[model samples]
Target: MKWLEGFQKLSSVLFILTFQGANCQLAVFPIGPALVNALAGSNVTLAVSFRGAPDPVLTWFKGNLPVGTWTLNSSSPPDIADGSRDVLRIENNGSLTFKGVPKHFSGNYTVELTKSGLGQALVTFTLKIFESIQNVTLSTQPDFAQEGAERFTLQYTMLQGVVEQEIWYFNGGKLKNSTRYLIKGRSLVILEPTRTDKGSYSVLLMNPFSSVTTHRNVTVLYGPDEPIVEALPAQPFYKVGDSLVFSCQAEGFPKPTAEWVFMGQILSDFHQGVLNLTNVQTSQGGVYTCSVLNGLTEEKREKNVTLNVYGM
Candidate 1:
């Protein structure tokens, strides 16, 4: 009688195991951290899956409140527990989807699965919805700064959620925190900005979910450093039919204009900084002056070149 009783107990345990094994196994795909990131006004889906029982009731809860539910084998649409039926839906594969998600939809979500004669299972996820970065603007306090004299600042602003990172760029290259550059939360300060500091400045703001970028041009006023003159042919003395080409150049913002002066007269036609003399004669020889002027800086500089022409 005792052996028969033991056999009966074992038989009962086996029956329970067999029945549980036949139940549906609920699971979430790519199962690492159950976190979902989505941008506001975007369509997003939170996927889930199950095996075994073909007909199972799935109930989705946002936080503690029920949001939606559906029967896997039912042809009808998912029943919405809340008034968000138009924005939320349950797919045939038991996944929850959101159409044009709003910021208010960010919260914890849980899905429970159950069958008529099977065990129940539930999974949870943390959904984070963020507003897309937009309306970004970049500007500078002073439209233009003076080289070696003024501190320049570039600032940026955007309308969006919290930004996780702010990056600065100068001339398409990444900028780092240094003595010359001061990077604030939303601004960049250039200490004693130089001519080299002038270019396109950009700011990139980003978070774990979204990113945006904006840029602005910066101007720095500096030179007419010093006028420079270069004469093409080898110089010692030029005779009869010598073609002489002189190039005048200077470094300045707004591009300094050059005026070539032979002896004491201004060469009007050589305003482009190039002086071309064809068939140079003995009389066309003296100290030539190249005057460079920066209209913006109002600074002028002069360089002289001596050309000695001998009689043929």
Candidate 2:
């Protein structure tokens, strides 16, 4: 009976050793990095390695959902493909390759290997797929702003990804936040814009992976200031049959138009900002008025000059 008990104890020790030997031979491990960082539309691979086994059957899962299944000795390919664009296949070494990975494929992935006579083995990996910015556009509500207005806004739109940083530039220089300029989220506000605020404005959006920029041209409409008239000779009196040249100028945003008035009638012969009088007579020597008009601001300014013609 004691010998029987001794034989039973030997059998139990042998069973334990055999079980540990099988566990050591069937150990499985991942071959590559546990974490993968990939860009959208790019390809990536996840690999695993194992020893011994009854020809393991590998299965890939995204989160808790099954992605594909493949048997090592089987002649068939992976049982699943995400879509026509997202091509997925299993290689001979039990590695999964994704061709043209999509943005939505960023998540946790798990691979499970099972053999007929061994315990299952699992390996997990974290995948991060970054989406790049495809396009950017900028626009304004009114396109044109009036000087001394309450406010004007510039808006921006991005094609992909969340914005990590946003910066604005005016006339190729960076814009600062002040009482006149305010930046709120993805919009830029101009408080009481003046003629000096007219220029090219751009907004740049940046993320962890990429950056994009969009630009728009802004115009501020103002008024025509007082007109200045200059005589060619800088003299108040000119002789008969003498040439007289007068120039008028004004300051405005859209560029003001100038007209000349002789006596009480608009001179049809005079155009632009210059008034030329040749062979001046006493009748043409009265008061000459230079009038400037700004169509956008609906403002008009005029300047008058007196000339007396004497007989030569």
Model 2, range 1-312, lDDT digits (tens) per residue? 999999999999999999987667565677868988777788888877877775788888889988888888688766874663256777788877888988788889888898876768888988877777667888887778878789989998767765657899999998889998899987999999998899999998876678888889998988787888888977869999999788899988789999988867887666679888899887777788888998877778999988889986
Off by over 4 Å in 2: 1-132, 310-312
Q: Provide the overall lDDT of each model, using Cα atoms, as 2-decimal numbers.
A: 0.84, 0.83
Backbone clashes counted, model 2: 0
RMSD of 1: 9.6
lDDT of 1 by residue, 178-229 (tens): 9888998789999989988878889888877768888898889988888778
lDDT of 2 at 133: 68
State the TM-score for model 1. Answer: 0.49
TM-score of each: 0.49, 0.55
Cα misplacement distance, residue 291 of candidate 1 (Å):
1.3
Evaluated at residue 89, the lDDT of candidate 2 is 75
Which residue pairs in candidate 2 have backbone atoms (N, alpha carbon, C) closer than 3 angstroms, thus clashing? none
